[model samples]
Target chain A: MLEEAGLAPNVERKMRLDRLQRQPEVVGEILKEHVERQQQTEGLTLRKLSPGVKAMIWFLRLYVVFMTVVVVVNVVQTVHP
Target chain B: MAVQDVGRENAARALDRTRVDNARKNRKKIWLLWLLIGPGILVMLGENDAPSMLSYSATGSQFGIGFFLPFVLLTFAMAYIAQEITVRLGAVSKTGHAELIYRRFGRFWGNFAMLDLLFTNLLTLVTEFVGVVAGAGYFGIPAGWAVFGAIVLIGVSYTFRRYWTWERVVMILSLSNLVFIPIAIMAHPSWGAIGHSLITFGPLPGGWNSNTIIIMLSDIGATITPWMLFFQQGAVSDKGLSIKDLTHGRIDTALGAFLAAVAAMACIIATAPLYIHHMNASQFGTAQFAQALVPYVGHVGGALFALGILEAGLVAATAIATSSAYAYGEVRRQAHSLNRNFKEAKSFYAVLFAALVVTGGIVAIPHFPLEYVVLIVNVIAVLTMPPAIGFLLLLINDKEVVGEYRNTWFLNVLGIGVGVFVSLAGLLYAMTIIFPNWQL
Candidate 1:
């Protein structure tokens, strides 16, 4: 199963021992839950949060407002000045 | 045994995901750091444009290499201190310098800054075009063709959808600034005398006169100004630099300052030949300077001076026009990314194109006293620098803005010292302009 998951063989051993050492009871419970959940589910996928999404969205909104004002003002200023 | 293998697989997968996440974070930090350094180098080299070359030429002609050579280095140092704060502010706050000023200082101060930037930027744009035309004149290209060609170049650059491409192209062209280095070597200045002037900084070859003061102020103006503050902050924000990249950005600024000083000093040395010969270069342009050098250092030296002027104009126009666009984009909160397409940042692109067109067109007009415009634009840039410095220093120190990346006490002291010095220089320059005989 470790080979199927594509984990380095040594890393797999290290992770197993580390998790087991930290909380033997919790590890037993989590492993049981994972096995049960995996048997019931078709596939497992990783969940990740996209870093800089908020900043990108904020910048996009800012640019829209900024461009609108500049066009309107530049058109007006050039016409008047 | 099967159960043990399955459990091990589950734990291993979790660790792999964590490692992947950590690696992604590390890469993002590295990217952000690299982006922060781009603006300082671009702006400093851009500031070393055609008029700056002319200003150095004037200094060399009027005062020789005794006092002004070292003095140019001092002004560039002051410029470096003034510019470094913008790096911290932009990296920490993730906003342009102009946006910060408007938000914190209220409308009155913001309007003042915008007004000062607009006027100075416009005037400086005119001079940049003038430089283009003047350089073209050396190569037998008519002023109209030169201006038209420049407009087309600017238009095509704006049409590109990526900032990285634009920056790389401009940086490559700016590398031509090395032309001045060879020109300086061709002139063969006294090394011992040059070193002595740097160390002792004595012997006013021209004496303290009106001409000396005018040239001094022009040199100061050429080194530091309002656009640099706007340019670098806008660049850092657009590049999306975070606090992690601040050190890299500082290093970039230091390297840029060093390069700019070297270029300026080279111009002084290149022209020292005419100075030593007592050639009256009161009305000479870059072309004429090149021609004059032919008699002393042959055609190669002359060709280099002219080519350096062209490169200066080309690189500076790229930076100056982009600075104007950045300001427009920031104020309107429109698509400001160099990463954005023209459709995405249409107004930003449009403003940049229009500035280039109008500036080039204005220079093409027959019989315009273009030299005076060039001279005054530089004067105005220096005149408008003090307030820009004040706001930049304030923003960098604001805890809410810069947080842990805030200016150190020593940096703040250096910033204020530069501000005071610039303010005094601006006042003296203004007095000289008004009175025209205040220099003793």
Candidate 2:
């Protein structure tokens, strides 16, 4: 099971697996979580963002762009002048 | 997933599994804690980047250790409030921040968040290299070799192709940020003044003005920023933190905040002598600050100060570059784990290294206005934060994503409070810029 789980052969790996071998239920649960995590390629599907949230996100996008320009202009003026 | 990817990831997880197993059996809580505490510490100290440290230096020099001292603490408190959410989100969903945004909000909005992260990250990364170059200059090292050495050092950190190995290496380097504390003590600051400032949070010295406001915004930016959100969440997920690890995660984050806040405060205190002695450090660069400190801190302390900046830049560059790669790989659905070898996570490693090389190379260009980027990067980080907080709040509240981990009302209040505070701070900064004569 340890080899199948891709744990490379080593004394440490052997010790850990041995310890886990004593607790079959714990090993099963850990392996189960590991496999589930590995198989999960995609996560939660698209959330239907509310209109208010959409508007806010848009506002933030523009806010960031606007602020970036402001900062660049400010810095350029300071540096060159 | 390819077999190699799975094997690499499983190999990383194998370590986590063993540690967690030991934790569950009540065997070694301290050992488990030591193992689990990476992302939080990294994210916090990683944020004590070159520019941020310089900003703290500026604060201490310009304002001395009074109002801004406590203000710095408040900002880290805000950082803690915001970063704690990422821990819960990552442990529960096991998804990177970008992946969650892309998966839930779809591409359009996700791309905006990506733009904020990548743009600021690139600019911030450049400033970090600037810090490296400047700090090395203090030691009479030329720019070319400094940039080359920094890139090589960062590259070697991940050559192990193990997340745990990479994290541990960076954590040790990150702790060097505390070099500021000794320098601070060496400066011989008034402990009474420091305690009074912490307790009363007053004597803002110059009072509220455009310069003070900008410095305030910069200090806040230094602590809380968009990349921190993405980086910590992505790191938490990549570290394979499960629901059971949530307690350790929060503790790790709080400890990180405490340490980072101390380093930041120490930086301010170390430089406060400049303000006290009425020296004009208003425009000192990273190297300049170190050089000027020699009179107060002596040559050795000055060297340590410069080394702190150097380490800050190196550690933050690694983390910010990795955060960029994590976002890129997650959005593209490519193999992104640090556990994977370069062959398995080619695009991931490519994005990471490309960001470093390009930004590092830019620092070598003649007359590149590198200081301007350093000056504005922290402010830009602050401006881009409100929306990031908005998205974080939404995602953390989404039942389908965090389920049982959904934030309670108390957490919501704190999260929303962080968003409002950041937004108001940004607005206040804009106000100062737009109406330059405005005063509080």
Candidate 3:
């Protein structure tokens, strides 16, 4: 199914079964160690964006709201004042 | 020496494992998220570019933020809702919006949609060029020079027959819209008044004047257009998103909406300095407005504001022009992917190039009354949204097409509500334009 979606097929079962039934005990142990290492490497790690970039995004949002109000006030003053 | 060599060997083995592990992780990430996210995010952000930003600026200048700022964001939220449905429909059906319309609703309605998209898109393209010229004119660049330079840049970007490369180039250009945020900061506005407007939402601040109504409607129209629907869905399919990536697609849409809304808000704020100081130049050209901004925002900030306008125009013209090409490609059953070479999707590329050339060329003409072009582009975009929303809701609910991924009841309720709101907005705008003082 994954292959049809242009993805790799999850062949973990095949790999595991090959180790369990076809490979010798010592080879199976080595294969298990390799698979365990692979899984460990594939885990997600969270990294933060640079502080400067974060500050910039925050400043941008606040500016939008502030400027919007000032323009509205200006429009009001123009019409009524 | 022995201990050091052993340590190096162990480190090398660890490095090899880490590399293989990283590849596997990346592969999973690509499959799970990357493919689905690209097209939707690109389309939404691209839609927010040039013309939309300018429209928001006009909204602020003419009406201020009162009814329109909240209203613009609300309309954009509706746009996101509508676009979210398209994301699902595209991923599930693996078909273009135009293709689905033809297959299910037959050719007449489909042809009607095609006509509307092409006409509005071409007109909007002209306005985009007007914006480009206006922005370029700020720093003393001639209109002809700016238009020609933009056209050349667009041509080069489209030369590569790969969707990924095209998406990346457009994304990079679109990011320039963020320049508005800084300009807004430089304006030094009053936060208390802004918060007050948000709370009260009353007296309209500007009142129900003709100009206010027109600007409000135009801002809404700019934020949510019929072309956006066709563009995002076509882009999704062209980019080859599947069901597995649907969640990522939704995230991409949400993020795009947030960014686009921010850009829109930034534009309004950036221009607020002029609008607030009673500096109503009532200018038709973006260059004039941008040029006027220099005195308020300082030379550097003014330059950035002008650049924002230019980026908005270039990015939107590319997307709007591409929407036309996509619709034509779908209807004609031609190869439509940006992945295909120009010769492969000859009619598709030709239509895209033709729209850009004609529209950009028109704006280059001296004294073109481009304001009228802007008015028409926005008005037509508003007028066409209801039908597009209706069709979108219809297609997404069809079991034959969407299967199990069809919209839930909550989505349908909201979608219908959006349709009605857009319809009324369109009608009100039409009435306002046709009979400017009818309410009085």
Q: Which lDDT values do the candidates have, in the order given?
A: 0.70, 0.87, 0.68
B164-255: candidate 3 lDDT, tens digit per residue: 66887887788787788888778876666556555665326456766666676677777788888998888776665556557778888887
Candidate 3 clashes between residue pairs 3 or more apart in a chain or in different chains: B50-B312, B50-B313, B134-B287
Which consecutive 10 residues in model 2 chain B have the weakest lDDT in total? B1-10
- In the range A1-81, model 2's lDDT, one tens digit per residue, is 444544333333445433443444444455465445434525457888789988988887788777777776667657676
C-alpha TM-scores of all predictions = 0.78, 0.94, 0.78
TM-score of 1: 0.78
Candidate 1 chain B: 10-residue stretch with minimal lDDT: B1-10
Candidate with top DockQ is 2
Over 4 Å off in model 3, which ranges? A1-81, B1-35
TM-score of chain B of 2: 0.98
Question: Candidate 3 lDDT (Cα, whole model)?
Answer: 0.68
The residue-by-residue lDDT of candidate 2 on B309-346, one tens digit each, is 99999999999999999999999989899978899899
